[model samples]
Target: MAWNEPGNNDKDPWKKKDDKNQGPPDLDDLLKDIGNKFGGIFGGKSSKGGSKKGASNVGIAIALIVGILVYAFSGFYTIKEAEKGIVLRFGQYDGTVEPGLRWKWTFAERIIPVDMQTTRDLPASGFMLTKDENVVRVEMQIQYRVVDARDYIFSVTNADDSLSQSLDSALRFVIGDSRMDDILTSGREKVRQDVWKELDDIIAPYNLGLIVVDVNFKDARPPEEVKDAFDDAISAQEDEVRFLREAEAYARGIEPRARGRVKRMEQEAIAYKQQTVLDAEGEVAKFNKLLPEYLAAPEVTRQRMYLSTMESVYANTSKVMVDVEGGNNMMYLPLDKMMQNQSSGQRTLPESQSRANQSINTQSTAPDLSGRADRFNEGRN
Candidate 1:
């Protein structure tokens, strides 16, 4: 085919101009022709052995050069102390690297770093009701860390935001489910445990690679909206307690006083019994002292006693009559019978209650009868 042919010109675009009066070959174009002619000479047409191999070699070299450049520029990575590295091969998670310098496939692998340190707190503040119908406000704090690096990378689409959202949900469950009064002060420790447990339950299902350390209650107080009402209720409760305490104190005070009074009464009874026994013993001692003298001389002592009795009787009687042998003039009176008569309302009386009755009853009966004194003189006195 000649370069001037229409069909030949269509086959080779370079011959679009007049081929007989060819212009000077371009340097860039000449180099391409040389490569093509040499490759055809050595290569076979049936299998395209040499030309195919040479093209393949050139392509491979270009790729290697680009790969080497990429590696030299950025291939090594370093994870900080509080960080975890996740390595991905072809956009898929391959392995996880801990805190250290590690080399990975630059073109075929990607690395992601996640913070493994304690994260920002999620403090829950709200008011809720207890089982007993009491309302209280609760304040809480949450601490967490990153545990799994692979899961942090590919298990979830957005791991960090997912962990935070799960934490928020856990806080809501702990605060809303638990009783308000318990959350405030009494069962704070239990609430913290529950919060942690709930967070774990939720995050584990999501595979977000979050690890819960602890949940703590910082400050729990009444809401400002109902502060005055709550304060009033508390004051009422305190008043009731104070009243009960005062009543108990009063009872304690009265018990001691009553006990003292009882003790005093018992002491008085014992003292009276002792005094009576002492008086009886003193009387017995006086009688014992007089017994010896009386026993010394019988007749003389008897006469002396009789004379003394007459003298004393005369000293107390204004008038008296007497008869020897205690005859009819001696007044037949039953003294013992009249003394025991209770209907008379008189006992050891007349002499003490009335002098006239005493004189009528005993005057003639108890006349002076001393042998030493003249009988008539005794009667007259």
Candidate 2:
């Protein structure tokens, strides 16, 4: 028969016999029964032998002590040298912890270790349109390190991804305003600087707890379809720059030498001008000193001047003339022959006497002496 069914009188298995209603035992009754059993084992003051209340108190104290020990030990954790710990108490923001041993309640608090000292790289690249409407592929890398652990974890959904997006935006913004030639060649450093500045500005308001360490402009190139043409153009530009540099260097090296030559020539001209001026002044002074002497003795100074002039003129002549006192008989001297003999380291007769004797002998021996004299006089005329 079922326990709750009306049937032959069999005692209910789940309830006491004196109770009229048959039902499951209450929580208090079950507790009292367990207490009675524990009290009986410990020799309470009954047939069951001990106080149930005292045994219950002792069991509760032992459970409480064990729970406290487990909670305290579970709170101990270590934070590494390169990491900063962000503690959250009861799922709310708490204080930060530095590197070392730290303690927090196991269930009530949580620790998130963030690496603050390690550098991270975020690479950004894409094909962008230049201001000149040319397409180019540019790649850049940014190095960053975490500065604030709390902000790194809490300020954004993802700091690294945010940085990457910012980098892309900055790179595109700068590239969009730059010419293709600059992006692919000489303007790369300027582009890199602009991108870095733009990226910093973009992320500054968000406080993503990141500091940019360095920016690397890796590479930039024109589209593959026109790569060869652009390469040739770039090579031409490089050669042009090299030629310009060489020209500048040559100019620098030659300019000083040219200036020195011009200066030397100028100094020589000045010295020559000064020497000419001094010589003119000396000649004027000499003429002034001789003027008084010439004025005092007119005939003598005139004759002396004439003789001196004639002497100066005749000193350079290679001929000798002899005047006969009574007649028009003139003798020509072969002074050129005498000079030639002297130049040859040989001796010769005196030019004046030799010329006089030659003229007498020629006149005595010549059959046409009168015609020779006439011809000589014509030549002299």
Candidate 3:
């Protein structure tokens, strides 16, 4: 039977001892009963006043301990390997925390985790006026990372946004100072370097705590209306550079050969000079030796010299022509044809011509030209 049914009066679950009411007990009475039970467990007397006081004290202590444990546990957080945690106490800078599990005052402190190792890319692009007042679309990218957590958080309201604006300002300054042709072509690298330097200068005073690792010149081109013309100009510049390099290479190749030819000419000139000097010296020595002989026997020396000159002149003559003194007739000797026939080994000369050649060779080799002078004198006598 149910507790509320008849003959179940003594089995009422909500009924207390010495209670007359059948409904639930009063709130104050129920609380008093709970306090008495707790007080009894803690060795407090069952008197109403002592039980209530002991229970109240015990409950407050237990609640305070539980709150402390919860606060300590909740304060624990982890800093990753690449991050540095910035701790703030009462909305003011406190200290920094390294990677690992860390704890702080739960409600009195806060941590802002900043990634220190990751590289981030920020791009700046716009159509800007060049030094020549020409508008060109230029795009650049900078790789950066946070270096100081405190400065990154406290120095600026927004560090990343500040860096981005700095980039834009630096890029615009450099672009405005550069020519459009350079921005779109060969000067792109130089422009990129200038922008990097300018950006560093701009952000250094602000202390945004960001360091730029690299600056890249992504793209630069004339406006779409002038794209084709710029492309043509760029191609022409490339061709000009290529031709200049080719000309340099050609000059390099020809320079060595020209130098070699000049050296050879110098050597030949020196040899010719030396040979001329030696020949002149030899002629002077010959004249010095012959001076005494010429003084002693002038006629005989003159005749010998004349005969030697005639012999040397005749040695090179292949054909000789002699005119008869009294008749209108000339005699021609074809000595070149005779020599050619003898060399060919195909034709034999007549016996009379062979004897004549032998006699001519013998006379040409005779060594006593001075004796010939004496023979001429004897014939004269």
Worst lDDT 10-window in candidate 1 = 363-372
Give the candidate number with the greatest lDDT: 3
Instruction: Give the whole-model CA lDDT for all candidates, comma-separated.
Output: 0.65, 0.80, 0.82
TM-score of each: 0.45, 0.66, 0.69
| TM-score: the better of candidates 1 and 2 | 2
Tens-digit per-residue lDDT, 1-381, candidate 2: 666677653556767777766677766566656666655666743333344574584586568779999888888999999999999999888979999998888888999999999998999998999999999999999999999888888899998899999999999999999999998778999999999999999999999999999999999998899999999999999999999999999999999999999999999999989976886687567556655665556556556766665564444335544667868865666778878865554235467645544434432432243344446557978
Give the Å error, residue 173, model 1: 4.1
User: What lDDT tens digits, residue by residue, belong to model 3 across residues 1-381?
Assistant: 677876538778778878867876666666567766766776755555554575585686578779989987999999999999999899999899999999889889999999999999999999999999999998899999999999999999999999999999999999999998888778988998999999999999999988999999988888999889889999999999999999999999999999999999999999989976886687567656765676568677777876876765565444445667868765566778877865664245466555555545544543354455456567978
lDDT of 3: 0.82
Clashes of 3: 0
Q: List candidate 2 segments past 4 Å from native.
A: 1-71, 314-381
Q: Please give the clash total of every predicted structure, in order.
A: 0, 3, 0
Model 1 agreement with the true structure over 229-331: per-residue lDDT tens digits? 7668667766887999999999999999999999999999999899767866875574456445555554675566667657655554444344668655657
Candidate 3 similarity to native, TM-score:
0.69
Candidates ranked by lDDT: 3, 2, 1
Which stretches in model 3 have alpha-carbon errors above 4 Å? 1-68, 320-381
Q: Sort by TM-score, best first: what order?
A: 3, 2, 1
